[model samples]
Target: MIKNSDITVVVQGPVVASPDRAMDEGITEKCLTSVRHHLPGAHVILSTWQGQPVEGLDYDELLLNEDPGSNITEYTADGKPDASNNNRQIVSSREGLKRVKTPYAMKLRSDNYLVGDQFKFLQASFPERCEEDRFLSERVVVNNTFTRAYARSRRVALHMCDFFYFGRTEDVRALWGMSNLPDLAYDQTRNGQKQYWGAPHYKIDCTQKLLLVALQQYDASLNVEHLHDAPDDLIARSERIYANNFVIGEPELIGLGLCSKFGPQERANRLSGRLTYVNFDDWQVLYKTYCDAEFPLGMAPLRIRKRNFLRAFLLAAKLLEEALKRLKKKA
Candidate 1:
């Protein structure tokens, strides 16, 4: 069993100083306090930009570095996403992981905090793996919030969640130590030409890019060109990779607390007893489909069966809704 003392919690990213009276403390301070409350003996490292406020923040070590400037957002007739903090995440996480002397570590966001330590059990729970596809010695536990279930509407490949990760220090380091995102990757305009509008190019989101880069280290032959809307084969390969390398669960089950600023719609969606994202049950099914031997279909858990049924129904409704919208537009 890995004790709290053997784990270091690296809270990386910008500090969230909330002004709400309901939650008086700053998000980063609250995050550290959560670590102390849940895992008493765990070490906490706050890694953020040098100029960020740090007074009264509760952490064992403070790491400050020059801000790796944000990517430039390319505007087109078709709206492109804003500049992501991929570079910031990469630098802060890699540096923080390097400072970790403990056996296990968690890459937590400064805005996020822990509610419990139940996630530790999932770190080494799924030991069975396909030798060729196995990268990490044990599965890294990740939140299901952004871990999409591509079997449904989303067809993203290698779109692993980067929100929070808990695993062996070496494994976490390897995961975040990948190359920084290139300028051309996000900025899809050159010579005043709208490259994103009508041009053949490989585009991938930060989450997909990060995981695919790490996977490439173990299997150089693997190729993931696009972020989402991937081919079926690539999607299957992604499922296999995730099943072998990750344990995805709900935020609450994984002892994660979302910051108040993490959108109210998402918070309500979570509270509605819906299983839209890839939850632990979905991960188990993926594991069985790829890594483990197939069991009787009827033997699957009732909740999983219900979840699948609901997913199918919801997908049908979504398709119908889209069709209706198209008809309305045509009319």
Candidate 2:
């Protein structure tokens, strides 16, 4: 069993954005409550932008300040304010790491919720480790995981999911020391900077990727391990299907309401459990059912306005093509 005294939980980043302030408070409160419940007695800290109000949530400590060298007007590659938001995460998380007095620490984004018994999963997956053996993450976002195929075809380094991370406080602090990582990565990969190469060459939002590179510069053997215990073969198969269905396939699954329930986030939540087992065949059946459903015409307007329609259309076409190819191979 993982004791609260064994670790510190840092809830850092921007407040949950909601048109309703009450809704924001409710979401923040729920996240804090969940953290406290799972890791009872763990030191909990809330770090946010300077002047941001955090009155309702209960925490052991609260730290707020503008990001070092921040310029509110600068925009990230993803279009979020650079200094105030993206850069702030690096700054706030670093500060949070410094305050951790325990051997282990977890850095969770404000909006990222831990469902069910995820704390146990963390305990079993990571456990107590020497400083050298303490690198682990919920998800490692590789170039091929979510980016466009062309972008992934290049030699861009793998990325860590910025949502949640658990490891030794020292390792976690090293990972968070990435204030100018995006620019640094861009400069190193300048040869790949072209419109055809895709967004990653220019934008450096994947701090986890940059962290790995930084760690490797000192210790070549350091690698971030996934927090789940699925067999390697199973994980590889699941990745292929997921890449096909989501990244390389189509967006019609969303219209079918299947994706909202069984999407990547849901899959992560399920797999993080101690007993949850994933069956690829079952997922295949779900995918077929989703494809058979009528394309949600009504949703197209909203999705297009949100700039996701083209990506969905392309994904759907790719999925259909892959399916047909598979049928041909079976014949």
TM-score of each: 0.85, 0.51
How well is each residue in 1-331 modelled by candidate 2, as lDDT tens digits?
5556888888887665533222234556677787777677789988877766687778999988674543342334443443323466677788888898987777776765445434333234311222222233321111121322112112122332355556566666666765543432223333433211124324433443445455565557544332222345534433332222221112121111111233456643232220122122222332333332332234444533433444345456656877888799999
CA error at residue 56 for candidate 1, angstroms: 1.1
Backbone collisions counted per model: 0, 3
Candidate 1 global CA lDDT score: 0.76
Candidate 2 matches the true fold with a TM-score of 0.51
Q: Assess the local accuracy of residue 216 in candidate 2 as a C-alpha lDDT between 0 and 100.
A: 62
Model 1 C-alpha lDDT per residue in residues 6-46, reported as the tens digit of each score: 99999998774323212324878888899999999999999
Q: After superposition, how far is residue 307 of candidate 1 from its true place, in Å?
A: 1.3
Which candidate should be chosen as best, given TM-score against the real structure?
1
- The ten-residue window of minimal lDDT in model 1 covers 16-25
The Cα local distance difference test for each model comes to 0.76, 0.47
